[model samples]
Structure formats: C-alpha cells, structure tokens
Target: MQTISSCVEAIVLEQPFLEEALSKGIINYSALADVLQDDVSQTLGKPVKAGAIMMALRRYKDRLTVSKPYYGLNALLEQLGDITLRSNLSDFTFRNSNTLIDSQAAILNTIKNKSHIFYTFTRGILESNIIISSSEKEAVLESFKNENCIALKENLSAISLVLPKHNTKVAGLYYQILKRLAWQNVSLYEVISTTNEFTIVVEDTFVDSAFSIIKNLNKN
Candidate 1:
C-alpha cells in the first residue's frame, strides 16, 4: 500500500542516475510521471494515476534536492592533490586460467625492479584483463611470453590523480568528476577507485587536456 509520495521518494533515492538528472533540471516531469506511474503501480500491485504521480513528484522535488548531499566540483577540486603523468607504457591482457597463475607471478617479479607506471588485475568469468605497465616494451614482452597472453598493446599512458578520502555516504562525487571528462570527449581506458583515492587511465594524447579539465574543477 505505497502512496504516490512514498513511491516517488523511493524511485528518486534508488536511482542515482535519475536523481542526478533531476538535480540538473534535465528531466521532463510529466513524461517522468507517466513512466513512473507504471513502475509504481507494478510495485504496489495497484493502479496509480499519472496525474497523481506528477503532483507527488512536484511536491517532493525541493525536499529531495535539498536533502541529497551535493559534492560540488569546486569542493572536490580542493581535495585533489598531485597529478602524475607517465608515458612509454604498455598493456597486457591474458585469458583467465589456473595456468596463468605462474605467468602472473613472473610478470610481478619482472616489474619488481623496473620503474613501472600502473597495474590492474581485472577478473571476469570468460576472461581476465590484466593491465600492467613499464617504460620498456621489451621488458614487458620478455616477461609474459610463455604465459599464453591474448594481446599486448604498447605506447599507452596513464595519468593518476590523487584524491582525499571521501565520505562513503555522499552521492554523485565520482559521477561529478566523470561527467566533466565525458563532456569533453575524453575517453577513459580504466578507472581505479579505492576508499580514499581515485585514478583514471587515458591515452597519452589526452593527458594534458584531461589534467587541465580536472584541475579547473576547483575554480570558482
């Protein structure tokens, strides 16, 4: 027995992307109400009028906008620390298997002495994408050869942005950062996120522009 008010609140809270759209004033309320009425009716196992849903949405808009935590780009920019750019890097991907275990160890050992840039172990069901980096292409190739790798891509680069620890409860912090980059048509290769830090990997060509774009997020 969910009322229209409760249903609207639930929808807004549950969907971050939708909430973002609403916050940015990009959503058509009447169209959204029509869409949500059906979803609400399905969830409640009862009929809901689109007009009623629209009224509820209008009533809740101000409260929801105010209650939701807004992490402004300017504030986030203040938390941004040093930016590191690396070039002459390479990426290696291997199919996931128990046999690749030894190859993983060998790859780690090879980079132990060399000055490498970035490494990520992304595991998947069908296959695994292991991306590692080094200044020397030969060093990367020599280390993982007998390991049955699927692909080796060279001349890749990475830019690491140091970020301060953010409160987990806050919403839209990462999205805000990503939105700026997306708007500028900067393609992200990989994103590494930890509790206290976030890193984005992109091609060497986009490094300066990306850095400038992110750095400007702090501007008034």
Candidate 2:
C-alpha cells in the first residue's frame, strides 16, 4: 500500500540534499511537509493532510537521526596512512589497439632502470592512460608513436592516499572524502583507486589546496 510514510520515504530518497538535511535535522519539518503535501496526496490517490505529512517527516527525521550514515569513518580519515605527492607529471591518453600492450611493455622496459621515476598506467575499454614523470615523457612518446594519441596533459601532480584496509566495508567512504574536495573547488583531472589505495591527479596549481583539504577532512 502507498501509505504516507512510504511516499515520504520515496520522495526523500529521490532528493539527496533533502535526505541530508533530514539526517542532520536542519530543515523545518512542518514547512517541508506543507511543500510535499500535494505530492503525497497524488501518490496516495487521496488528499493527504499537511499535519499527517508533517508527522511522517518527523518520524523520518527521527530514523535518520538514529542511523549514522558514516559511523566510524571520521577516525579513519583522521588516520590516513600516507598522503604522498608526485609533481611534474604528464598524462598521456591513447585509443586502445592491439599493439598497446607491446608499447606498454617497451615503456616499462625503457624506464626499468630509472628508480627515481614515478609512473602509473590504466587501460580502459576504449582508451588507455599513462602517467609518468616528465623526465620519462620522451620514452613514453617514442613507445606510443604509432598509436592514436587522443590527449596529452602536462604540468600535473598526483596525490596518492593509503586508504584504510577496511575501506571497502564502509559505505560513502569515497563520497565523504571527495565531497570536501569538491566543496573547496578543487578540480580533478583523473581519479584512480584500488582496494587499499586512492589517487587523485590534479593540476599543479591545485595540488596544495587539494592536499590540504584532503589531509584535514576529519577536522571538518
């Protein structure tokens, strides 16, 4: 049955900002109920009272209050293992091809002896990207000379995070960290993550602000 409670939940779930406000108990329930009265009435196929909608919202707020969406996540942010930065990097993206794997091997083979270089590669269905120190950019370009180069971004930096081991078990772990960075207007070029590591590649100019924002997410 499409009861008032169920309708209110449906509406709240569809609006993430409203749900956040409800969880934080920052919104006025009566006013919101007045706004949602018509929607609830239409959903229930009856004229729902504002007072009844307000009661449902109140109950929803109570439930949201008791449920911690990010329980035990703050401490994990506070204890981020290591926030390392590698600067003066270049991002090369090329359309995928059969010889792509051979080029990757050649690039690795060329830079194998350069222990000071930092590099990471990711292959997608349609494209592949290679991030490497500017010092090794020439070798990557030489290796991929025959491939279709789609994009090349230079003067970038990467911030790598050692995520908590239990990160996969916790919900909203990435959202909580990325939300703060978004709020600060930090622009991300690429985001890469694994089971226990997360990396954010950004313009060199924004690295400090992004680093500061991520380093202190727990304080906020």
Candidate 3:
C-alpha cells in the first residue's frame, strides 16, 4: 500500500529542513530523487525509478508551498504585546513517576507565598520539565530528591511574549517567531507557550539578543 509518492512525503516530512528547502524550491528535485531512490526503493520492498520519485517530490513541494499561507500569521506577529525577561532561571528534568505530581505540588505550595517567583512545569510522557527561579534551586532539588533527575541546567533566562488575542487562529505563528530567532543564531534551550503567551528560554548570554530579535520581528 506504500506508494513512491507516499514514501517520498514520509521521508521529506521527517526532515523539516528538507521540507522547507523544497517549499522554497531551492532543492534540485532530480538530484534529491536520486539520493532518495535507495531509501524509497527499500521502503517499498522494490526498486523505483528516480524519475518517478522526482515527480512525487515536485507534487509534494507544490502542496507544501501552496498550503503554508502566512497572511494571518503576519498580522498576528505585528500585534505582539509586551515583552519581558526573567533572569537567573534554572531548568530541571525528571523522569515521570506516580509521585512526580506530589513532588511538583510541594514545590508550588512552598513558592505560593513568594508572589515574585517564576515557576512553570511541562509534563511529558517520559519526563517532566520544571523551570523555576534559581533562588529556589535548593528547594526544588530537596522536594524532588526522590525523583529520577534526568538533567539540570542553571544560568539561564526566559523571555516571554504577550501575544495578541486570537493568536491561535493564525497558522504557523510559532514557526514564524522561531524562524526569525534561528536566522539570528539564537540558541533556544526550550520553548514554552500558552494560547496568548509565548516564551523562550536561552542562556544568560543570548537573552538580550533574543529579546531584541523577537521585539522587532514585525518591524519593517
């Protein structure tokens, strides 16, 4: 049931850079097809002609370029609201376990009185990530002492954005913002976002540059 076209799409989609290059029509389709012929043939359990793969690549490129309209996305970027930075943040990751919630709850309960403290949690299937003020590093470690610590990083800062209302209705909003940051070579440790709030965490050194890049993303 796996056709050459489907295989080509699956392979290209796995690599975002390739998909982007193809969308911009920067890649040589025939050359790419030749490169992909082996993978495609192997995936299909048979040999496929490079010309056939090339045709499939062309069709996929057409769809990718046509479907990624950024008209609404542009307007959304132009409407970004206040930008703020929080320094001296620490990042922690722990494997998910039944008691992970209890450990997180303890941290929150302890920080509740400190209205100025910054804290956020993102729970994944395999692990949970916690970002908190570095001042509270000891507290977090003690609370999560029993948990399996996967990683811990300090000397980082977070830059958060206040997005315009109805930002979710626009397509590729995050991609546009992140693309600009990527162009400037800003290294992002993590990206966190809510419906109307977007935040990026980077090392202390990159915060100012990242802030500047995002603040002027809409300017001509």
Estimated TM-score for each candidate: 0.72, 0.85, 0.75
lDDT per residue for candidate 2 within 53-80, as digits (tens), equals 9899989888887786565776677667
lDDT of 1 by residue, 1-220 (tens): 6777897889887876677677667889899998898888987788988888878877777776686555454466677777777666666777677766676677678767765446666666756665666554565566556665787766666666677665354566677778778878899877777776677777777877788877776664
Cα TM-score of candidate 1: 0.72
Candidate 3's residue-wise lDDT over 51-122, tens digit each?
A: 999999999988987787756777877888999899999999999999999999999999999999999999
lDDT of each: 0.71, 0.89, 0.91
On TM-score, the stronger of 2 and 3 is 2
Instruction: Show where candidate 2 strays beyond 4 Å.
Output: 14-17, 30-53
Q: Order the candidate numbers by lDDT, best to worst.
A: 3, 2, 1
Candidate 2, poorest ten consecutive residues by summed lDDT: 68-77
What's model 2's overall lDDT?
0.89
lDDT of 3: 0.91
| Best-first order by TM-score | 2, 3, 1
